[model samples]
Target: MAWLADAVVALVALLHVYILVLEMFLWDRPAGLRAFGQSLDAARASKVLAANQGLYNGFLAAGLLWGLWLGPAGFGVKVFFLACVAVAGLYGAATAARKILFVQTVPAAIGLALLFGARA
Candidate 1:
């Protein structure tokens, strides 16, 4: 179960990294524009902002990976980052897109649940 938690955490981190790449590197590209469903002009207009957002996503991934690297001692770190992800997802869902709830919040929620269950 702990392994499962770790796996989920790792996957979340990877997901964030992928987002980072999409937003930072590809936000103005066809891939990023398509993924975000933004028009090319809009993507170009907000490229800088998207890159900043991507950097933050990279930070989130870094934090999760850091927690994982700490082994059992990283429980607090994992929880904190997962909570951040959940909250962010919720906010995004409310303001940005409903899909965010399923994409970001649910997975973090699942990871947090597995972490708690593993502890139990």
Candidate 2:
């Protein structure tokens, strides 16, 4: 069960890194623009804002990694980060995109449950 929790945390961390890349470096590019449903020009105009959002994603990734490295001490950290992810996803689903609910929040919620329920 601990291993499962750890694997889920690791997966979430990796996904965050990918999100960071998409928001920070590729927001104005084809993939990012397509994902966000924005034209290149619009995406370019919002590049700075997207970069800032991406930095937050990077921070989440860092926290998850730190938690992973800390073993059992990581439990709280993982839960916190996953909670953040869930909130962000819910917000995005409400205002930005519904896909965020399934893609981001659901996985994080599952990971959070596993982590919180894992045997010590």
Candidate 3:
């Protein structure tokens, strides 16, 4: 059960890493533009902000990976990071796009559920 939870955590971390790359390095490129559904002019104008957001995503990934590295002892760390992801997802869903609920919130919620279930 714990392993499954950890796997989900790892996947979420990897997803964040991918998001980081897309936002930071490719925000104005075709792939990022397609993923974000923005015009080239809009993307270009927001590139700097996107990079900053990407850096935050990288930090979230780093925190999750760090928790994973600590094994069972990192339970609190994992929960904290997952909560952060959930909150961010909720905010993004409400303010930015509904897709964030599926992409970020759902996975984090599943991971959190598995984590708590494993403990029980």
Candidate 4:
């Protein structure tokens, strides 16, 4: 159980890091645009905004890593970050994109449940 929780946290952290790269560095590129289903012109226009969004993802990743480093205390950290991700996903789903709900929030929610249910 502990191992499962740890693995989930690590995976979430890795995902966030990937998100940071995609948003900050590749938002205007073909890969990033395709991932988010944006046109090249649209991606180029939104590069700065995507970079800012990427920074937030980096912060979330940092928080998860910090929690992972703390071992037992990592539960709380994971919950907090997951909640943040959930809220962000919900907001995105409502205003920006529907896919955010499933891709971002659902996994975080699952990980949060696993972390909370794991034996400490």
Candidate 2 lDDT at 57 equals 95
lDDT of 2 by residue, 1-120 (tens): 999999999999999999999999999988898888999888988999999999999999899999999999878888899999999999999999899999889999999888878854
TM-score of 3: 0.99
Name the candidate, 1 or 2, with the larger lDDT value: 1
- At residue 25, candidate 3 shows an lDDT of 100
Cα lDDT over the full model 2: 0.92
Q: Candidate 1, which ten residues in sequence have the lowest lDDT sum?
A: 26-35
Encode model 4's per-residue lDDT on 47-109: one tens digit a residue: 999999999999998998888899986778878988898888899899989998987888888
Q: At residue 47, what lDDT does model 1 achieve?
A: 93
Model 1 agreement with the true structure over 1-120: per-residue lDDT tens digits: 999999999999999999999999999888998899999999999999999999999999999999999999999999999999999999999999999999999999999999999999
Model 1 ranges off by over 4 Å: none
Flag clash pairs in model 2.
none
Off by over 4 Å in 3: none
- Expressed as tens digits, the lDDT of each residue in 17-50 for candidate 3 is 9999999999999999999999999999999999
Top lDDT: which candidate number? 3
Error of 3 at 118 (Å): 0.9
lDDT of each: 0.96, 0.92, 0.97, 0.87
